[model samples]
Target chain A: MKKTLYPVLSVITILAFGFLVMYMLYGSGETPIFIIMAIFAIILGAAILALVWPRFSGTSTVTPGQSPFLVSRGVYFLMVIVLLVSFLLEGFNSSSPWSFLYPSENPFVPILSIAIIVGLYLVLYLRKSVREKYSFVELWTMKANDEREQHIIDDAARKTYGFMRMLVVIMGLGFFAFQLLGMSFPAFSVGYILFLFIFVAHAYFMFLLRKITD
Target chain B: MEKTANRLRELRKVRGQTQEEMAKDLGVTRQTVISIEKGEYIPSTTLALKIARLLKKPVEDIFWLE
Candidate 1:
């Protein structure tokens, strides 16, 4: 029952993803709906793949302290820097750096550019070297392979949750303070706040995990 | 409360088992074995039993309240 269910789920996820991509590229209107659907599909696909691939590939264990990707720490840091710079540029110019490529004022262009960049990263991530070094499940979910890894993950998660909770409270107070001062919050600041929050959370989590493991 | 401690490293060494071998036998990562030996982490009862079984010792003989 489990074996058959996995394959069926995999097929359904793949077909849904394919259809979503086709619709996104060719379909018109309902951009928000498509965006939400895309996010949902990607998440569901990742979860299913994480659970199923490990059992099939026989790579049940991962080195405790190793990164899930073939990319070096330098590369990861470089990507983060690039993302930060792009966001800053977009905020200043009121348009993405990739706007010139599409040459349109459509709001979805930036979103499309982000999707393209993510897709490219996914392609590189699935290259032969990475596939050989790490299982698909490990790469996709960053799931712990053993008790030590689980401990590290839990430790990192606990710390990150605490940090994020504090951050959210501060952000809420700041927003309230601005409103009380009769000041309007800049729309772009919202994006910046979200970006920084996510970036810091991830960096903090990784730092904690590395420190614990080391 | 008394802190828990263990003679994991010593017992595993006496059994002529490397950390890697012990981890494999216990179905865990080597780091877990190392952490247990270092007293940085405590194993759950099930894992403690497994470790005792692997080392051919009683759980109480391997672990103690200190």
Candidate 2:
């Protein structure tokens, strides 16, 4: 069941990602043929790499309970680096450091970012340490392996819900204040808020899991 | 208030089972076994029963109010 489901889901996710990129690049305009070709080329290249990657055997070097912490920290670091790079590029291109926060007009920015993201995701998915414990689909879905893990997940989710509720209320009030002051909310803030939502949820889950497991 | 204490570590050692071995037999991670033995986390009733079965002991024999 998983063997077939995983591949199917992978293809679907990749295709969805490609379409998302296309929409981001040419929302109302016609997408150029080369852009479509480039996206497909990148996807095909990634698929080939996944198929040809050598399978790993032997004990995982990652400590039994430490994988979540390591993965979270790595993801957080990667996001920070990506954000900084985008900021720098935006500043260099437009003389506005905050331009990257808005949707980028340069097609290369989205394409490059998508390629890097897909490439890194494939690398992590194929990593021996991660692969030994979880399948690509399991990793993608964040499936729990045991009752204890499920418990930790549930607790983490509950805490995250509480935290996000508070955060949303505060953000709502801030936005309301902005509206009263006749200030326009930046579109980039919505994207940043979504990023923060994901980051905080993962961080919370990893922190709680590590604390319990340790 | 009474605190819950457990004899999990001692009983596991008496059975000559490593944490990893116990975890495998109990269908849980070694970290779960470690946490239980250290009294850092209490197990659910089902898990407690599973552990009791693995170690050939009763639940009360493994855990008690202290």
Candidate 3:
């Protein structure tokens, strides 16, 4: 089932991207339209990278005992650094006068947009990979059959997913309350705070859940 | 963390079968057979029936309330 779909999806994505690039380079546009199109292109490009990530990337051969925390944290940190640098350069720099930039308005909507695109792809990839790959060692007994092993593996994977979900909602609330009550400046201060909480909680929970997985 | 069954394990050994051989015959992983022998996992009804058939016994005879 999966082997057939992978190649098909990859081809579709490549065709979409090729069209986007050719249209952007050859098509005509002035300042306003150009900026709008550039923003759209950047977003679409990031989304493609995320969506095709699974096809290009192989599963981490890391063992169950191995922690993916450090790697994930490093990736998250690098992302934050890039966004922060871009924000600092664009915003609060009067000489450059890029009017589109504003911290109060979170000029980094494109970054969030990229993250969302990647996240959606990851969710889909994991849903497929976890079931097919895991050996389900704990579930098999000398007396057990294939059906028994499958049932156990399926149940354990689902339980891990459920715990992750709970942790997300819990940690998200934690960050939201911390930010909203701690600081306020903008119109949707409350909403932004909630979003920030959810994002941070996702990182934190990603770290914490590794401990609970085994 | 919980009590489990190994009646199947004892029976399989009495019938003279290795974990690897049993797993092959049952179409499951060796680790599953090990887990069962160690009383770490319980077989489902279908699996229980399969095991019983292999051992030439009834399901109830092979598994009991222990």
- Spell out the clash pairs found in candidate 1: none
lDDT of 1: 0.56
What's the C-alpha lDDT at position A46 in model 1? Answer: 62
| TM-score value, chain A, candidate 1 | 0.39
Q: Evaluated with DockQ, which candidate comes out highest?
A: 2
Kept native contacts, fraction for each prediction? 0.31, 0.54, 0.38
Q: How many backbone clashes does candidate 2 have?
A: 0
Show model 3 residue runs off by greater than 4 Å: A1-145, A182-214, B1-6
Indicate the residue-level lDDT of A13 in model 3.
41
Deviating ranges (above 4 Å) for candidate 2: A1-140, A186-188
lDDT of 3 by residue, A129-207 (tens): 3324333321111111354444443333334333433443444454446557975333332223223433453333333
TM-score of each model, paired residue for residue? 0.54, 0.52, 0.39
Candidate 1, A28-52: lDDT as tens digits: 2446655765675465446545543
DockQ of 2: 0.43
Ranking, DockQ, top scorer first: 2, 1, 3
Scoring only chain A, what TM-score does candidate 3 earn? 0.29
Give the best candidate by lDDT: 1
The 10-residue segment with the lowest total lDDT in model 2 chain A: A51-60
lDDT of 1 at A176: 56
DockQ of 1: 0.36
List, residue by residue over A1-214, the lDDT tens digit for candidate 2: 6445444543443344333333333432435743764575466536532431211111224322332222223333443454445444653464443343455456565446546655555554455545565564453345465666666654554465345434544565565577689886654343344344444544444445444344
